[model samples]
Target: MSTVYDCSRPQERKDGLAAAASAVRSGQLVVIPTDTVYGIGSDAFSLSAVHSLLAAKGRGPDMPVGVLVGSWSTIDGLVLSVPYQARQLIEAFWPGDLSIVLRHAPSLAWDLGHTKGTVMVRMPLHPVAIELLRETGPMAVSSANRSGQPPASTVDEAREQLGDSVRVYLDGGPSGDPVPSTIVDLTGDEPILLREGAVSIEAVSEALGGVQVGRPR
Candidate 1:
């Protein structure tokens, strides 16, 4: 059985965050509301937890998972090096809707599956998500839905898809628009646009001082 918390209530919000953090630490899955859509998340450094998250979504490990951080400073410890362009982009759109891919630090002992020594990370703007992340550290999060299904914009929709697989569902109400964060790859010398979602390519270029972003191949 899973617990659903209506975060509109103060007490429930507090309880939910506690339960969700506990679940993550115990290697369980949790559903959280992000700025764009609901996400199914687990402890990023826990290999078993990441596997469970992927299993719940009927997703393959080859696709990999993205990690969500609580703040900008949290990113410094995860990546091998934060390039100048990455810093500029983060300053321009962090805590909003931008995901950046960079080489992961070799010292870390986590497996997100087939990431090829890289990790996609972002800091979401949603309060519930940020609070949970701050308490639990980085989390491997993917859209709250089964494979081949539409992303869940509401907690109800997330529960319908993930069901008992998720230990806790933090309801932050309807996530307007359901647009995903734009993904930029900073592993190479230049920035590459892997996917364009909420943030536009034009906006990204402007943030990087007119540097051309390689279009999605």
Candidate 2:
């Protein structure tokens, strides 16, 4: 059985966060809560850990995972560039349900199952997740559920699906939304909507000054 942490209690939350950080450092997978849904994550810099996370989810390499960052400046360290429009979107909707995909910095040595040298990134809207990210630096995260299955909304659901595959599960109650983040590919001249979730197309388009393009369903 996985080591589950009750985030509702103050002491347990701290202990759980510490344990989760240690697990990531030791190249183990962790299941944590995000703004949109429960997520399974691992240290973004750990190639073996990232691979383990993917294996746990039975996910394909083509379906890239998103990295959760604690702050805006951290974004520059990971992605090659953050466009002006993209920055606006981040400023407006970040710490919420907006995820941006950008060209990965060739200098960084990490595997996140991305193709064409790009990676999806987000700063989740949950305080617990932010606190954990602040400690772990950055985490490669995907919804805590099997590929093609409905995303896990509660910690119990995540436990049911992920079980012992993950070393720790930070129980932050249910997620803010059952849907995933609105994924926007900001690598190109025009922003492309990869997946529509909490943020609407019109809002994203306006944030990008009318340059939003929706991805094909």
Best-fitting candidate, scored by TM-score: 1
- TM-scores, all candidates, are 0.99, 0.95
lDDT of 2 by residue, 1-217 (tens): 5799999999999999999999989999999888889999999999898998899888877777779998988998887887787789988898889988889899999878755899888999888899989999999999999877788999888878878999999999977559768888877766788778889989898877776476755
Task: Please list the C-alpha lDDT of all candidates, in the order they appear.
Answer: 0.96, 0.87
Q: Which pairs clash in model 2? A: 95-125
What's the lDDT for residue 18 in model 1? 99
Off by over 4 Å in 1: none
Considering only N, C-alpha and C atoms within 3 Å, which residue pairs clash in candidate 1? none
Q: Per-residue lDDT for 199 in model 1?
A: 96
